[model samples]
Target chain A: MTSLRHRIQAAAVAAALAIGALTACSGGGGGSANGPIEYWLWDSAQQPGYQKCADAFQQQNPGLKIHISQYGWDAYWSKLTAGFIADTAPDVFTDHLSKFAQYVDLKVLRPLDDLGPTSDISDGDYQQGLAELWKGQDGKRYGAPKDWDTIAIFYNNAALKAAGVDPSELQNLNWNPTDGGTFEKLVAHLTIDTKGRRGDEAGFDKAHVKTHGLASEGSGGGGWGQTQWSAFAGSAGWQATDKNPWGSRFNLDKPELQNTLSWYFGLVRKGYMPSYEEIGGANAVGTDKQIQSGTAALGLSGSWMISTFTKLTDAAGKKLDIGLAPTPIGPSGKRASMFNGLADSVTTLSKQPENAAKWVKFLSGAECQNIIGQSGVVFPARPAGTDLAIAYNKNERKLDVTPFTQQVKDKTTFLFPVTTNAADIAALMAPRFDAVYIGSSPISSLNKLNNQLNDLFKVAQ
Target chain B: MATATPTQQQASRRKAPTGYRDDTRLALLFILPALIGFAVFMIWPTLRGIYLSFTKFNLLTPPKFNGLDNYIRMVQDPVFWNALKVTLYYVVLNIGLQTVLALVIAVMMQRLTQKTWLRGIVLTPYLVSNVVAAMVFLWILDYQLGIGNTILAGLGLDRLPFLSSDTWVIPTIALINVWRHVGYTALLIFAGLQLIPETVYEAGKIDGASEVRMFRSITIPLLRPILSLVLIITVVGSFQVFDTVAIATRGGPVDSSRVLQFYIYDVAFGRFQFGYASAMSVALLAVLVVITFVQYRLTRAESSDLA
Candidate 1:
């Protein structure tokens, strides 16, 4: 009987410790000039490139050093927030446009304009609209733009060949809310049944698909579905919220968005895509794994996942040949992609704020951007950096990354919604999105959520 | 076996000799560190949490008093209601299955195999973290390519969506947690079983009472205190479940699996609504308190029939 009591006691202790750790300020010994500027990032792929940049940065500023800490996407925000509450936040940390607003709202960010080194970079210095996302409502720069990513489609070459689909047909794939266009047709062809019949063929079995035409995006994609339905909806002249950065209203209630979502989720019904229930589990399988396992023939994904898709191999170690293509042209007569970027911001708690700003400035500059681009991990914020990555991809990786760049070139991209209450908004819409995906809830249910969503955003009377 | 005879006489009735100048002083001195540790780690945080429930604090900003606002919001919030409902469903299912299985296993082990090695083997899953267990099950129970579905397919059976379907997710997660916890629960019950005298069974056999009757009349009646203890502990633990749901479904498939604790976590950490989260936690604490009290009263856990 004491064993049960002991177990309860142990659980209590663990809970207390967890709470204590979150509130405890464990600040480092670092206000000194010679101390390393604490830098944090979430992406491990870009770790080595940033390490190289850190090394170069130290040499350029003699006696100034940079310490880097990396965490995964989920851990990064919680850790950062905890660190902030505890006054132990990193001196400088990479920031996503989607998450940037909350910190600004809390006054935890140190504006870059106050720093001398950051003065050189201007609106024109970075990729289009990248600079504008970092601006607070107070007209201060919260971050220095570093890198950008756009969405595209990753297809398995061997899978396409096995399904007797031509690679060229992928280039001209189109979509609309009325009908799924050539994109759906190609997807259906690639969707083979276990009995060896295509999705478009007679006597095709949707229940036991040998391979799904499209993979799940690993989530309900929150308020916006950049890699899921955003591209299609955007091409249909629909935006997630009424505006970017500080939109008080939502367009989720729009017919364009609903019809677009209906068609997108209808693919699951037709067996072109995996049902949400099939793809959901512990750490749900993303497009990267789905495509690699030959579960999905095509995966619409972000440019940041370029490397992950490229290096996929089966259980037998047979390398998968992944091809890239732009998203299908939708009703607006052109393709669309959600263009988002990451930047570095100096934390208000940073003891060595000036040094942190300098490190952030260096990261934003062409020199470090070029290094990041050369590593072929990400497309750097500067055009020079993008050019380097393009060259590196073409020369070393034998991969053409122009579909991502072409969106930037053609200006057919919209910014990921950047506003406060993002988490509240996401939580509100997520279940509804899941319901729609699982085919249990109607798409028009979004209209109710959309009304509730604006209440959180405090949409103007 | 030693019988647990009534020791009704109070052992703590002696006077404190001249204003606490004897063993009491020494005892207080000896227990001072532990008291301080408990206060700092448990009591202080709990008090702070209660204070926060009445305020509006986002962790970054200083708290502002907002009387009953969070409680009001929670009452009106459909997600909160859904979370509470789902959590109750999960708790009832998990506790019901786990207690039964744990009791059966404990009885079987007591009768057949009392080997320490068997106990250790049974307890293996209890030691594994919820995250690891959830991941292992995810691989085994996955709808698309899991070994479970493969076996089902080989038998010409349709694949079941274990963790993904809204209907299946709650039961699946409950089963996962039950698997992780049943061993430890069984061990606790086994410890209670050891307290039963072997002579009781001998007497029952001599009296021509069946084993099942002996178990029902003697073992169960004698085990009431421990069973009630186990129920209180497991029920409270089940309601506070977060780690498995966090690692697994993450309250998905139309929020069918969003347990109360998970929702509170999302409010605090995910959405930074610490004040509202604190209020929700306070409500959960109150619920657990009432439940424990009710269980104690119903089972008469304070009085033992051992003697």
Candidate 2:
């Protein structure tokens, strides 16, 4: 009788374990037949707008459901890579043109050519050289342009006013390596040390700075592509792989590249900007903290950060006033901004290709873009949608968002290289920049970078 | 006639009972789920990965195998060599540091019976995941806000570059890896240390043996088995070091810190050369196997002599 009882108990335990495993496989809100499609996005700042789009899309398709997952950018990429390997990539995802080449090369993304023709998007409808950014090596489009972002200077108007300088004069500040240009004067005037000295004063101690004049700089260091070390490539006229779209040869050997690196490093060597050690914390935190704390007078960032800064009420609930300007021109005698844009991509692993395509089209459509534009999450890629962005910034946010859009029109922007080997190249570049920023290496080491870049690209080609 | 009846009964039993069918059914029922699991998760997927490696199979399109091409290209790849050299360095450094530090700590902890809580606290870092440990280290190594620079400055010294210099980046990251993993390894050694029976040391004391002499004679011999196991595990684990390099240095500063795993990553994801990456993986596995085998042989030789 006891043996029989033990057998019965063992059977029950096995059955219970089986039931749990089955439940794990079949459970979850999106797993049921005719359930909603799951969408994952990185930016929490843009979640509400995305939800708004989802609601509108669901209104059109009553049977379909949309589940959205949000993570920080770093976590998002990490999760996406794991998911891609698992064959569980999202049905649709936001793709950056710069890094999309890697995914395209991996063959993880579904080309939209099968869905429809390029006629839906006319060259005339979008900014010049912008819409074509999403095309892969085979002349097939992978991602549809979602938004455009450019580098801009964000300063504190209150700080400038207190320093008895006109903030408006910094609109097109002439700059050189030797003299910080008009920026030098503005920063010097604005920077008030505890002993009533300024950064430009003769006896000012750069080592023990009481108040800094500038924010963070260098690549893998801070700012966007322009503020980062990659912009030095543009300043020195060094493209990662020399040529358009995808170059067969690397151009790291260019003298201009080395000059750009050295000159940019001079910013830290000369006490103009914070060293790598000083800028050491979170990627976006340092500039925001420096500007907010009133220890630093000027910071460089994009318009996206305006919402982040202005919303931060002090301990007493006082709102911070943020100002904007274009990125200072490098030594090239021509100011070039690094242009980055997001793309809407469909996943080949997705079971519901039609539904996924529809969702992708809807998200890139003007209606959804307008909703996103109004939220100030990104600079809308569409011409009509961007107008909404401008109006929203001017009327709702009471801040000018034109400089970023103007960069789209001016053609002064260098889109980050989109190639199959971009990720490998970036992996190669990030650490060298880290080295220079930390003061352990000289910027002239960029010469070595040029050679390595050439070798890396040669293999890829 | 009775013998004939017994033979008839044996013949009937030899023909097999109907209850044996139920045993077959039970065996099938027990294995069905596991068979399905292997089909879905392991066997099917491995075959797919192998096929995909041969082809220019980006995840987006149907796979088209290019055959031995990826393997051929990998032989000539410069980054591959660089990555191999870097990874070898990391493995050697991580194994050397972890073993030395773990052994030292284990020996120390064994001597300090009064501070039992300290032993538990020392192992806390190993309990934490690599991701969390990396983030904590990032803060500690932060140039301005980090305690590293602050402490140095307080001591009237200039700040040292922990992550930037090509010369120092690998060592600093290796040090961090050692610090994080030493505690777990030390615990293993401590368990081995405990197994060294008090009787052996007591016997040595009766013989007028010094503490150092006793340790050399008994403790070292007894601990060989554990030390060898730890060495093999540590070496294998160090060879596969990915998270620390990815999080800390990211194989940067002119690829000074780039390891073999990072190379495989670049090949697999960055270049979409899965076949090449797989080949690299296979090569690494062979190296690990050899190292483990040698360690096992050495340990077995020492252990058998004592027996």
Candidate 3:
């Protein structure tokens, strides 16, 4: 009996060791040709469009396949970093401008100089400056532009009618930092008190308001004001950094930025916008939901939210009428939108780097891009793809995206500020931005924060 | 079925070396897998973390030796100090409420019914993930639309900015964690209550002692060792508050709730400053060890009245 017990224990230990050895040996990338290329992205909205692309790519290349995985934006980067450390990272993944530079510095991204141009597609085939945006400091193209987005105004139509404002009135609105120009008047006119009084009317109570003119974006869009004050600040001739992509110093202390932010946040004080205390932190209501539910008349958001805004329904599930408009022209006498783009990059740890490059090429090429654009979820980077998206939204969704596309055509679009240490920059700037928005810290704190931001760059050097 | 006489037992004990070495070998074999798991997952990683504290490493890249640079920078970092202060505040509030509430509940359970089903029901919140708890509370405590605020408004009270206000955010989070953790802590104390013999209470009852007096004199003294253990676990867990803050606020409203663990994660994943993050982690580990030692000594956890 004793011998039998000892034998069983030894067998159990042997089984455990065998299982451990097997687990340890699996899940490695080998740069081999046999395995399927793993492709990952974070946007659930674009998953179907890419799935279609994947099907087409598989038919084109027999015996080769692509496995696509999607994670939420918050979990995506952390998971990818863990995958990289484990040497089990996806072969090809959707890359963001904010993070791609860091990945490149870490030498995890495979520069696409060898495969920059396929037979039918070239770098020049993409939207102007987009392909260049993915180039590393070494002048090697690390990714190919997949799609682009710009910011726009989404308004609730019923609210405008109740305020006695015309839709055309928003088409060419001009704004200034000092007085907020005609935009403030428009915003104020749309706001209503709990007693059916307009914000601009006599006996209008700032407290106990029924509807705000504009909805808050929680932490007021954090440091990246692309959806909030970027248009106003950019049109005011304020730049975030001395130069983008690789700026040595930040220009957040400039008067144009300071004045623009002050006016933007001052709307909260006037009760034309939700105060940070009213809508901030983890439980804050989203701007889109606020507009749909009549909490606010309108909101500024990225063009990618066009479908989301257009599909807003009330609590009773009744579809509400909505309108899209361009950002108000600022003090620079021109309207501006921040143009940000996404791209696909091949990883250095890919088991099938060549196949991953092929997949990236297909994603960037006009054929797959056009397929993606026809989905009308996002604007493709290629010009033809962009045209297809506009047509698709207009014909199928009955939503005109010309307000967004026109900025790109009119050269009124500024690039999203690209820089190294992007996450560090966001960390240093976000809390300070929140502080000012919450009215706990003065706006002057921004100037001091910028010095700290510049110091980060200096230390990096 | 026959019992051995003392003479026969002594004769057997003196015979054939008693096979004690064989039994010891079998015991070691049974526990070897657990030892291997501990070495691989816990001890190895801890040692590696200490080594990484003195080096610069991004997850994707090889670590570079940087000497004491990381520790030096950590010493001067105001954010680190702020995180430490915030974590200590959270620990005090969370542990204080959790311990007191748990003790009261445990006493009630001990005095009333000793039902397993009730204990299981009490521990339901602990079964829920921290992220799930935080997310649910976010909706429950929303100043505008949440049912919690709706109740307040219905009662003719102003809505509280539970998470939005920096002054309220930490306390709100502490309360949320206390709600999730107090039940499990109560069960631990309840188990401790079970170990105290019924004779001590019977004797007090025979002496005509009041329930309060009996509880104070008999129950409290016997429960000290268990209470000490519970405090150490709860305090350590409270100090490492990350998931709740991460999912709910992400250390927002001017860093009011940026607990030490959350700050370490941000420094590592957010900024890719792994070296600095590890250095901060080492400091945190040192603090926890000291705290644990002090708690053990203060509570006299080594001694128990029942023993």
Q: Which structure among the candidates has the greatest TM-score? A: 1
Candidate 2, lDDT over the whole model: 0.68
lDDT of 3 by residue, B175-280 (tens): 9999999999999999999899999999999999998998899989999988987887777668778889988888877789888888887888677777778788
Instruction: Give the per-residue lDDT of model 2 (tens digit) for B4-34.
Output: 9999987887789679878879999999997
Chain A TM-score by candidate, in order: 0.93, 0.86, 0.91
Ranked candidates (TM-score, high to low): 1, 3, 2
CAPRI band for model 1: acceptable
lDDT of 2 by residue, A1-461 (tens): 32223232322222222122222332211222255676777768878988999999999988887788887776676566656655656777877665677777767788887775322654455556767888887988887777777777778777777767686786777555556567666666666555767767788666665456777744553122445555445644556656668765656556666565666666666565666545642232356777776657787665556667667554576887777777666667656667777777876667776677777777878888899888876777787877877887788768886656666676767876666667666666666666666666677776787677677756655
Chain A superposition TM-score, candidate 2: 0.86
Estimate, for each residue in B42-69, the C-alpha lDDT of model 1 and write its tens digit.
7777777778889988877889999999
Over the stretch A103-155, how does candidate 1's per-residue lDDT look in tens digits?
88788898889877776669898887899899988889999999999999999
* TM-score of every candidate relative to the true structure: 0.94, 0.79, 0.91
User: Looking at candidate 3, what is the lDDT of residue A370?
Assistant: 97
Error of 1 at A210 (Å): 1.1
Ordered from best to worst DockQ, the candidate numbers read 1, 3, 2
